[model samples]
Target: MMASARFLIPLGIFIAVAAFLFKGLSLDPKEVPSPLIGKAAPEFSLPLLNDFEAPFANGDMTGEVWLLNVFASWCGPCLDEHPIIVNFARSTAVPVVGFNYKDRPRAAKQWLNRHGDPYTQVVVDLNGRIGLDYGVYGVPETFLIDQQGIIRYKKIGPLTQMDVSQDIIPLIEELSQ
Candidate 1:
């Protein structure tokens, strides 16, 4: 009985610590309404992917309501959602910026070439440092930044047509004014 009690005590402590760590660590995907809403978007400066040229920074996106899309060449859903992004760019005044998370330069270039780049600017976050700053837990997440550089909305998964029509389009419309 004493041995069992001793084991139980340690096990209980371990479980408590594990729970605390998980809770304190970061966001869980099931939690929908992100806290970034109506807050200034996180600032980051990352190297541009095209031609390995000038840096694209958060400062560059200020004064505009923009979409920041986190994608990876290796992520399948990103490829699936690429065309929708293109259509959005073609039809709307809202600009899209791409965060190429954790992809090789060659793959990033090829992905853009084959799928068509819809972003006004593309930044390659090779080590995911920028993504970490942006509170990204996964690829294919998108944040809507308002004209004053505040993050107004966050979409956690692959953006669907309904998401575009119901959430994104409405947010863009509201911000455009």
Candidate 2:
């Protein structure tokens, strides 16, 4: 009886761990929770894509709600998500800041020229330090910052039309008020 009890305990533990692993696998990777939500967004000052003469900074939007979109010329998902961003920007009063992540200035400029630039201001993040500060794990992440500069929402993957209409737009309306 004593020997059987020890064997059963290990088997039960293995089953529990397997159950947890299965549950984790079923969950969506894009829904990864951010620690920055409800916290103040990290401040950054970076060169503009159009005019690098004067840098654009997060502080410039101090009292307004805005969207920060992290993107790069080399990232395929950024290309997929660009059109959705362009349409969303037109429908809202909130400013959309494009964070150009870790791409050459000339390539980034040309990519924007080809794809159509939708940003209110495009900020260049040459080294990705600003992205690191914002806890960016991948390209095509987006953050919605409230009027007081607190991060209200963080979308880990590409923005979808349904995402903006269902999750983001309602939140923006709520935060704007």
Question: Which structure among the candidates has the greatest TM-score?
Answer: 2
For residues 11-127, what per-residue lDDT tens digits would candidate 1 score against the true structure?
A: 899999999899877866565677787888888888889856788888887788899999989999898788888888889988899989999989988989998989998889999
How many clashing residue pairs are found in candidate 1?
0
TM-scores, one per candidate: 0.80, 0.85
* Displacement of the residue 117 alpha carbon in candidate 2, Å: 0.8
lDDT of 2 by residue, 1-177 (tens): 999899999899999999999999989976778999999999888989889899887988999989999999999999999999999888788799999899898998899999988899999999998899999987889999988889999998888998899989999888777
lDDT for model 1: 0.86
Candidate 1 has which clashing residue pairs, if any?
A: none
- In model 2, the clashing pairs are none
The C-alpha stretches of model 2 lying farther than 4 A from their native spots are: 1-25
